[model samples]
Target: MSLQPIDSTQRIQSLDVIRGFSLLGIFIVNMIAFHSPMYYYDPYSWWGDSINRPVYWWIDVFVQASFYPIFAMMFGAGLAIQYMRAEEKKAHFTSFASRRLAILLGIGLIHAFLIWSGDILITYAVAGFILIWMLKLSGKMLLILGFIIYFLPQSLLSGIMFFASMVDPTTVTYFSSVQDIESSVANYGSGSFADIFGQRVDDWTYANSPAGFISIIIAILPLMMIGAGVAKTKLFEKASDKKLLLSLSALIFLGLGIAIKTSPYWGEKNLAFVFTQDYVGGPLVAMGYMTLLLLIMTAPLSAKLLQPLAKTGRMALTNYLLQSIIGTIIFYNYGFGLYGEVTLMTGTLIALGIFVMQVIFSELWLSKFKQGPAERLWRKLSYSKK
Candidate 1:
């Protein structure tokens, strides 16, 4: 079906507010991924001796499981909203949405290759492409599929770890070896600026190559679909209406985040060394953040503060790229050349500092500018003159 442009002025503030908060969430999580290893664990033991550092430990505990889920939920919300706009205009859906997704994919590829290796935009674009089809599914069905796709991988991985702990202590030991950890850290530390950039280019090329980034992105389709379903139903419309759901999600997220973080069962001997070394705590905190932010948006008193976040959310792509450019210069060898030297706690401070600046800047920028620079271009590119 042909899809139409959504009303520019008729946006729901809750979305922009949630999105603004989500941009911060993305930054918090991406900061860790930006500074540390590609995977959850640190290849180099830069932070190993300091893992017991209180600030570092706390950050890891709260942020690990948080951001991506929030982003996932937001993605779903957007899909629902977009589909609604299309329906409202009585336009066909597939072509326009596909064009948008394709642009996103292109942007993501550039982000992955030219800027950050840990870019989620590509993953989101890929997921969005598939999620559009589920717009016709009943909300309940969409919700069910969302949880199933989202949880299956975690459940399976956890099960494997549980069984391994019981049956193969030696194998787990090998996986957790100090020797392996040390070697990994050393490799990362030794890489030249050129080498790191080369690795990023390679990753982007592979992800966008004929092998297709879409399939890999499929892994997150369920989460995005659920998010879209949530959007369609106006789940965030009135947080008061869904107080129970919000509270429960907050509790579940907090409980799981704490459990996974503090569990000695997963313990110090495991990948906590890896996960804690980066700013792993941002995502955990981001969930708590979203819950609180959504609740706050429902309050009349906080509308002023909510406005900036909504503005930032409106220009999330521009802000996201800004974060990477700023972060890379501050941390990488090509710029400040302080990649391995900065502590996790300090890196997080830097992220928060930059974030506050962006919030203030975004608020001011949007006051005069109609859209983010990139957002304006995107709108121009995505639409034809009617």
Candidate 2:
């Protein structure tokens, strides 16, 4: 049973389109951290002036915690596709996937330490190693397991924190002091390259600490498993057949997601609310987005209009790294040194401008190359017979 090698021609347009779509949302979210010290605490307290407060509020409700789940799901779906192909070809799936993830981990390390402290690739690559073992589970089991893994730790942690906060209000503080905020502004906004690099190292260490690593693994592995389940069920492939289910899912998930995610604004941004919004509402909304896109892809006119997004999705790796490079240069001390200077609205506009440029660049690049440069390198290294 020999399977044909997957080529660009065999690529699924909807998957690419969704990936591309997620890129824009991700950039919008990441830009907040890129240009400010928002990653250290709630930006609303320190940086959200009156003019940009509403913008920050809207992004918190609608954009934050949404796109990353979609990206994780797609990654799982991709791995499942690879497994199926390997099975058909009787190839060494585990060995090949291990090699692939290892190379990805190497790339992530450089990206994380040298380029950006907020890198997600390292987490993805590490979680992917565990995902390979769970690829054999049934879709139903995978979904159940994914939900359990996603909710359990966060729920427990949030519950404990909530109770502690009730007993001791000081326990729940997430915002840095004004002094710390001012120091961050000085260090990142006007400091030299060495100063910025030191801060980046410290940030990376905290984010990739033992507990942080464990939490990321718990959160991400399930999404990958659910993605594998989606591929196995061919949910996207038979979209019309599952119209009723998809439609219902979209309505229910989107409605509930909006409700849960916006609850923080109405009340305090407590640990419980944050967990629910990120772990539960985030994935639900991401599912709704996936279903909505699938429905839209069925229409010829809509699909044609979305071709640019598909092209962008195909080059996701290149664009992702490009975003990090361009973002740091633009906002960090090394380049324009605009950190903590841009407002939320201005940052949002910058993200949109970058995305538009990326879309055009993606189309032009894909016209001349079968794969993005990074993607080509990844494949070559993964398959090299060293």
Highest lDDT model number: 2
- All candidates: TM-score: 0.83, 0.94
Q: What is the per-residue lDDT of model 1 for residues 1-386, given as tens digits with 9 covering 90 to 100? A: 44435554877787787777777756776776566653434322334465525654554455544666677778778777877877777876777778887888888777777677767777887778778877988667887887676556545655576566678665444233445334323433455766666756654554456545543465467767767766766777768787777777777756655665565325545433233312123334445567777767777878676787788787777898899988877666566656556667777788889998988888888888878887777767776666
Give one digit per residue, the lDDT tens place, for model 2 in 32-98.
Answer: 8888776567655655578988998888888889999999999988888888778777877888889
Model 1 worst lDDT run, 10 consecutive residues: 272-281
**What shift in Å separates residue 246 of candidate 2 from its native position after superposition?**
0.8
Instruction: Give candidate 1 misplaced runs (Cα > 4 Å).
Output: 1-4, 38-46, 50-52, 173-194, 202-219, 264-289
Off by over 4 Å in 2: 1-5, 177-183
Checking candidate 2 for backbone clashes, the offending pairs are none
The deviation in Å at residue 30 for candidate 2 is 0.6
